[model samples]
Target chain A: MTDVKALAQERQQMFVNVYRGKIPTRIPINSILSLEACIEYAGANQAEVLWDMTKAEPIFEKVNTDFPADTPAGGTRRYPSFYQILGSRPFVMSSEGVMQHPNVQGMEPEDYDDFIAAPYDTMIEKIYPRLYTELDTDPNTKALILAKAMRAHGDEFALLAQIGARMRAKFGFASIPSSATTAPFDFLADFLRSFTGICSDIRRYPDKVIAACEALTPILIKKGKLPVPSKIGVTSIPLHMGPYLRTKDFEKFYWPSLKKQVEVLTEMGINVSLFVEHDFMRFLDHLSELPENTILRFEYGDPKLVSEKLGSKFIISGFYPVMLLHTGTKEQCIDKAKELIDILAPGGRYIFNTDKGAMDMHGNITENLKAVIEFVREYGKYDNPDEPYDLSKDPMPPAEKIVAEIEANLNSKYYQTWEQYRANHPELEGRPQEVIAKKIKKLEDDMFNFIINLGS
Target chain B: MDRLLLLTQAISDLDEEKVFQILDELIAENPSDEEVQEIVAACQRGMIIVGELFDSDDYYVADLIFAGELMSKAVEVLKPIICSRKKDTIGTIVLGTVKGDLHDIGKNIFKGMAETEGFEVHDLGIDVEPDVFVAKVKQIEPQIVAMSAVLTIALNSMKNTVDALKKAGLREKVKIIIGGNPVTEDSCKRIGADAFTTIAGEGVDICKKWIVNSIA
Candidate 1:
């Protein structure tokens, strides 16, 4: 058996090297498979495992032992108990046991003005109830269900974390502490307005859509930043709706807020990894405007074009079609890896991954997937892995603009601000006031994140 | 430009207000059934331009969606006249988003465009099981069976649907076309679909060609 400890250390170092804009010994494989895929692959009943997440321990153990990748085995994608307790309309488990997020509109088209006026507050008051049926009840019942839902979420997360940690330790998977956030516009389009609704509102109420995104910018930033910031661990933001918009509409509605969130998170030393969905080829120039070393995993785009355009300024991964893994022979799959590595791995800032994450058991042929990963490991080495690269050439947006925006929007009407606290407790002066204010702020921030996370 | 040409341009532009204004004016003029048919055809031609622009990347999926909305709104203004005309239906299509997939955006877009283009679309709605699709086909005996799915797992469901149709002896009766995020050339062949598309406009165009070929 390989020295699991040394392998884990080496993988971590390689990822750190890449995050800092340096080439590693080989292209790091960060392939992600969905929870359904793991459970089904482990020969467990997916529905049963989803209901009792502890059943997934053996599944992850088997998968981590068998799968060849640099990244660790991920826990459950969404805590089923969390959504199940809340009776979440937008995200519900399908009959097949896989969680499906169908399009749902929590906010109506006419509610745009209200949503824009006070984004998070409106989400709590109007949208949350519509999305989570349990939360739509009277005050006492709503509070009780909300608490129960939170408890369920906590229990599931704790159990999964334990399983995830055990797998990493036993199997020597790289410890990449990451957080997830949605793009501001995607948060709006996904939960508040449905995909169809947002698309319609972009034409019908363009200004309001833009305003809602702007209002969401600060909250999304708070949601995106890691608890303890790291240079290597990324906050993955799955971008949606950009490719569906015209350049003019993208610029107006999507880009500004997203660009702000990325810049702010980047400035905070939190690496931003974007799962760029669909064809974002036209917006390549716009993406180039983001901070240096932002990891972009393209779902659909010409890899050559992406490499030629943004290779020097950013870390590029993805564009290996997962469908090929499902249908192609092992040789064909390896040939694709070679093609993408030749184009993207030439520069130091490339990671080998699939265009999109595997969704279910049908997403990949197991032998083909294993062979492709092994082939990438052998074939993806660099001749000069440690060559010096300068990221300062491509400048990120100034921090002052982002800080100002965040500060302006940080205090919400739904939560008590420090100023409000200061006004309320006039007797407590100086240090006492400051200490209480800090604790209050932390609690408020946590509550805000909890609310916003429910939407995404 | 003539009023018909103006209407075409407005629809193509997705200028909903202008499309409605011109439509309202035509309704006031009490246009004949043939003239109304000509107007509807004009609007569809404009929608074809929208599709072309979408293919060229000048427009987008959102534009296609808005164009569908624009087409429907224009049709609404012309509905009274359209009902009076009693035109021959070009074809019939049974459409749904397939089993275990609740996404209806793509399917709905195709249904709207196909309806405007004069196909009698029996929308079976989202998460439609194989038996539902089979039963719909048996009931309607439509010329086309369109299955849509955004999830990859739904691909198997689509295959199951095709197999179900074949088992029911309805496979040869209708041409199968699959649309959504997951369908590719390989998956289309795997699912035993006759055709596949990710774009609604393209899907409608394919259905139109299928009908035209069948009629010939």
Candidate 2:
């Protein structure tokens, strides 16, 4: 039998090599599978799998074995007990195989002081009651609830560890340390106030927001520095609220906390995989100021320009659009994969990933993704990927020209889409074309321009 | 100075205090119906400007919510005569976040915006069961049903609500709308909704436009 330890060591090294800016023998692939997608593939009952996780192992085992990932998908989603115990009002566990996040604001704007002063204390005492209405019961019952929750969480984590091991044993794929944490501002935006709430806070009470973020910096930094019990000593950070804000606002409101925490993580020799969600083309320069060896996963920014601007400073991944896999022909998908490989794989500090993470088999053409991944592994084999590519023929054009091209594409495509939508729905049949056209125009002129000028 | 213009500026500026102050001043004066009509028209005009500013990046999703809050205040102040005119309300809307999904950030904004756009809105907070929706539809017989959800799981709940409405023979009576992050244009068809949008404000606008066309 092949040694599990050997298989794990081999994959870990490949991952290490990519982040270290040294090309391994070939490319490495990790699966970013969500639990909802897993259940769909298995045809398992959603409520049974989500709420009662003991019934979920066999399904995960089959799926992992079927699609043997080089690095297994980290962080199990079968935490129903933990959620139930915590009275996590934000997340919902329905029988649809999909976990839902309710848009309840965990922390109000006025309560920044309490949060800033003592995060752990406030989260347990104040935030929990507000977030989970069920937990707002009398103190004695609340304590009992907290006790049960804490106990349930222990079991949940234990089950998750077992599942992670099962995948490694059965599929020869080990899980990496998943960072179950976020930057202070990201945490605030996502968990506490939400995007709308934070935006309002920024506009009205910029100082309080800034100060609160600053105060949370040490706490966040300590969390980043803490070791995760996994194969590789790496951390994951998903970024939001940065792309949506103006460059000035991002600089003031978002970056300080993130930078401080990241720098400490770097100092502590822990690698970070920062997933830049939505388009962050405008803030590429500001983000590039981050330390070398930081893995940047982009969602929608231009890949060629991304490599041009931030590639030298940070190891970049994620430009393979998931839509192509879902909709395009196999060849078309392969060609796009090849295109991403051509742009990014010439250097060692590049990893292969989708623009969006995999949620379900429906959203991804299984065969296409498998084929492209296999092809890229062979295609990306390099003696020295650190050697720069020759970019003489098709160099990047002016930013304005690229912006105009994007606008042209949007206007034409959106108009066609608008026509299609109208025909499909009877209500839009006699509606003026101007309504949809105006939306497209706004995307082209106002929104796009605003994003572009954020850096300027 | 035209009070209508002043109201419009106050809304555009997102000056909640100024809006309420002006509205109170107008109320105290015991204004005529023509004057009240002008004030209502100005509020609508201000909401449109708010939408415009949102598109321009001068405002954002939060601003839209804030504007909705302002509009709700204006509506409360104008409640005496808001429903006095038969056409004062463009249409009646039954609004709620679907069952098993307690998300109201988007729903709250939609309620505020729809109310501002002169629709008589009945907001069913969140996690509303399909039967409740069907029962409400039967009771109120609203012209439009607007559902908001941020979870894919709730898509099925939306479908269940649609199915419930159909089961009660009330599907044809109301045009349905759904919006949230998880909903796509395809979701509109899949869930048997007439329209779908991601933006709460835009959802309100779409309903307003449809009602306007049907009215014309």
Candidate 3:
């Protein structure tokens, strides 16, 4: 037990050192086996495990014991029972228990005006029922089912969170605090408009798409803000739809709001990591404009060019393709890791990881994965481990400018203002009122996030 | 510029409104069957320009998709004339997203482009199994069989499908192409596919080269 505690302390400290802009003894590998992968590794049925995550506790332990990684086993980001109760069209569980999100339309083209006018309200009133057909029933039945779904969602996540905390203790997994949000355009594209719908709407109704993204910007920022900001704790933004758009369309529709979100989040001392999906070789200039020390994980790009252009300012990771682990020899996998480490590990801003998480054991062989991770731990050492890079020198945008942007896009029409609520509760005052108000604000924020984050 | 060139330019530019207006004007003229075929051919040429623009990064997948929709609309406008005149399709293709993979956007894009280029496409839809593909190929005898998959697991399905074709003694009759995000020079060889590409335009070009060579 003491040895595990010491190991946890050691791994956590190494993560902290790298995140704090200090050169650690070696490159820290932050790979997490997906729950599906763990389930497969344990030979448990995926559908059975998903239905009752408690059934998979032994599997999680086996994963930790077998597949050595710096991070704990990833829990369910998509809970099937919650969606199953809602008769969800957006998130459907396949026969194999894999949750699949086929393209779905929550908002029609004509609904853009309504959506842009009140994004949250439109989501709750129009989009929710459209996405979850059970929510489209009679008012009484709708409320019952919605409450049941929410309860299921909460119960599932609460159990997963409990298991995750347990695994951290058992395995000495590093706690690099993490939360996730998608880009505004991605949220809009993924939820309100289907992929095909968005592509057509971008051409058929360009202005409306722009206005809709603008309307979504503030809400996404609110969604992105960490409850407790830490420089070492990263807010992950899994970027989608950027690579598929031309550079011109990308700049116009995608970059501005996402760039602003990153600027705002980073300025608040919360580090941001973008899972840069697909090849983003063309957008290096725009990416360079981001604040220094931001983490960029590329799925596909020229590693040498990315290292040359963005390595000095940003923390670079994720050019090692997971596919090679499935197909290549162990030596070939290690050679690829060495190649990426050579290009990206210089100047003290590289974290070793595969380009993507293994969805299941099929995409990667265990021998290759074990070999590459061990190789990185040994071969990625720095001669001088105590050198510190000054991250305090990272510049932030003007405080007033950030405040103004926040103020301008606050879609207050969608939520009940605090002032409005306070006026109605005039009898209560002083510290008691303040305490109650804080609790009420947290509830409102929770509900807001629940509505906004649906289908993303 | 002539109307065909103008139509071509509008499509290349992705001017949806202008494309419809020009198509509507051309339809009202009650032109000969040959002239109508020329108009359809003109729209096809416009899609080629779209493909070129996409390759150069001036356009994107969204642009290609939008252009496809525009082409469909243009085809709808010329459907009457097209029906009146019968012509041989350049070739036929058996296409699918392969087993265990439900992603169809890329497959759909390639189908639209191939149909626009006058290939008769037999789309097997998403999550199509190996025997289904084998059955279709044995039934229709297409010049080419194209498999698409986005998931890495589906690569195994691609190989299985190819192996099934070989087992059924149908592999020698048709050319095979595999495409999607996970495909590379290595996987293509392992899957026993004749060719592979990530781009829909490039895939169509490969299909055309095969047909053209076969004819020669």
Best by DockQ: 1
Interface C-alpha RMSD after superposing true interface residues, each candidate, one decimal = 1.3, 3.5, 1.6
Q: Judge candidate 2 at residue A246 and give its lDDT.
A: 60
- The residue-by-residue lDDT of candidate 3 on B1-216, one tens digit each, is 899999999989999999989988988999898899889888888888988887787888888888888988888888878888686899999999888777888898899888877899999997888999999999999999999989877888999999999999999999999989889998999999999999887899999999999999
Candidate 3: segments with Cα more than 4 A from true spot: A227-232, A387-414, A417-435, B134-144, B163-175, B208-216
Poorly placed runs, candidate 2 (over 4 Å): A1-5, A95-97, A134-139, A174-178, A194-196, A228-232, A383-456, B1-7, B15-37, B73-87, B98-103, B124-135, B149-171, B182-193
Interface RMSD of 1: 1.3
Most accurate candidate by TM-score: 1
TM-score of chain A of each: 0.90, 0.79, 0.92
> Clashing residue pairs, candidate 1?
none
What TM-score would candidate 1 get against the native?
0.91
> For residues B71-170, could you state the per-residue lDDT of candidate 2 as single tens digits?
7768788878756755667899999988867778888878777776778999887888899899999999999999988756578799999999999999
DockQ (Cα-based) for each candidate: 0.61, 0.19, 0.52
Instruction: Kindly list the per-residue Cα lDDT of model 3 for residues A1-456, writing each as its tens digit.
Output: 498898787777666667666677778787646777878889998888998989878998887777667776657668788788888888876534677777788888989998898888788788889999899889899989977877787788779878988989998877666767889899989867988889999888889999998888777776766644344567899998998898889998899989988888787666689999888999999999999888899998899999889988888889888878877898899999999999998877888878888887864478888888788888988887864444456554343345345644566555654555677787766648767877876666666666665758
What's the TM-score of every candidate structure? 0.91, 0.79, 0.90
By DockQ, the better pick of 1 and 2 is 1
Q: Ranking by TM-score, best first?
A: 1, 3, 2
Candidates in descending DockQ order:
1, 3, 2
- Residue pairs with backbone atoms closer than 3 Å in model 3 (clashes): none
